[model samples]
Target: MARSFTPKVVTANRLIQGDTVWLTANGYWSSDICEAEFITDAGTAELRMIDTETQAHLVAGAYLADAVMGEKGPKPIHFREDFRTRGPSNYAHGKQAEKVEKNV
Candidate 1:
């Protein structure tokens, strides 16, 4: 028996900055996962991944990653993807630092 296709989003890392990015419906990349284009069909998701790969200069490691449609947008379905959304875990650097610096 065949399993149904789960929702997904095309994801990649910016070639220069190496920051995680997701493909938007406008055929562009955004650092915010909430802007990702939610694909509910496996075939469509695969096609999106291929299309995203054509922009080699803009991004790399382009691939279709599992996701679920949320009220805001697509959310990561796996631990790795969820972890990536939070930026780095360092308490003194990255997203964490930005929050701390703002509160000071």
Candidate 2:
């Protein structure tokens, strides 16, 4: 029997800034995973990956990541993806910085 398809979201690192980004429903790349398009089927995930991969100049390491629906939006299912959502770990910068500033 064929393996069941798991829900996923397309993700990659922006080539210019190296920030982790997800493919939104409108085809825009968003830094927030909550804004990601949650893909439920294997066929749609494959097609999305094919289109996303073609944008090599804008992004790198594009792939489908396991995710689930959240109260706010899609959420990452894996530790690696969850870590990526937090931006760089070395310091407070990028998304992390923005979040810190907002909390103050």
Candidate 3:
């Protein structure tokens, strides 16, 4: 017996900067995980992974990541994916910095 396929999203790290990114439906990368395109079809997920890998200039280590439907959109099911969305942990920089500034 085999496990059923779960929902998935395309994810990768930016080549130059190594920032976490997700693939959107319109064929582009988004920093916000909520903007990722979720696919339930296993075939489509594999095909999408191939396409995502072609953009060597954009990303590296491209692969399909498990996701779940959230109120906003797709959300990371794994702790690793959730942590990537936080930008950085060392200090308030990148997305983290932007968030802090907006809150002030």
Per lDDT, the best of the predicted structures is: 2
Q: Which candidate leads the pack in TM-score?
A: 2
Per-residue lDDT, model 1, residue 50, is: 73
lDDT of each: 0.77, 0.84, 0.80
* Cα error, candidate 2, residue 100 (Å): 11
What are the per-residue Cα lDDT tens digits for candidate 3 across 30-95?
Answer: 877788888998888988978976788788999888899999899989987877778667887766
C-alpha lDDT (0 to 100) for residue 81 of candidate 3: 80
| Displacement of the residue 60 alpha carbon in candidate 2, Å | 0.9
Tens-place lDDT per residue, model 1, 1-104, is 55898888888877987767888888888877888889988778778867875799889898888998889899999998987766756554443243311110
Query: Considering lDDT, which of the candidate structures 1 and 3 is the better prediction for this target?
Result: 3
lDDT of 1 at 83: 74
Provide the clash count, candidate 1.
0
**What does the lDDT come to for candidate 3?**
0.80
**Which consecutive 10 residues in model 2 have the weakest lDDT in total?**
95-104
Stretches off by above 4 angstroms in model 3 are: 99-104
Candidate 1: where is the Cα deviation over 4 Å? 92-104
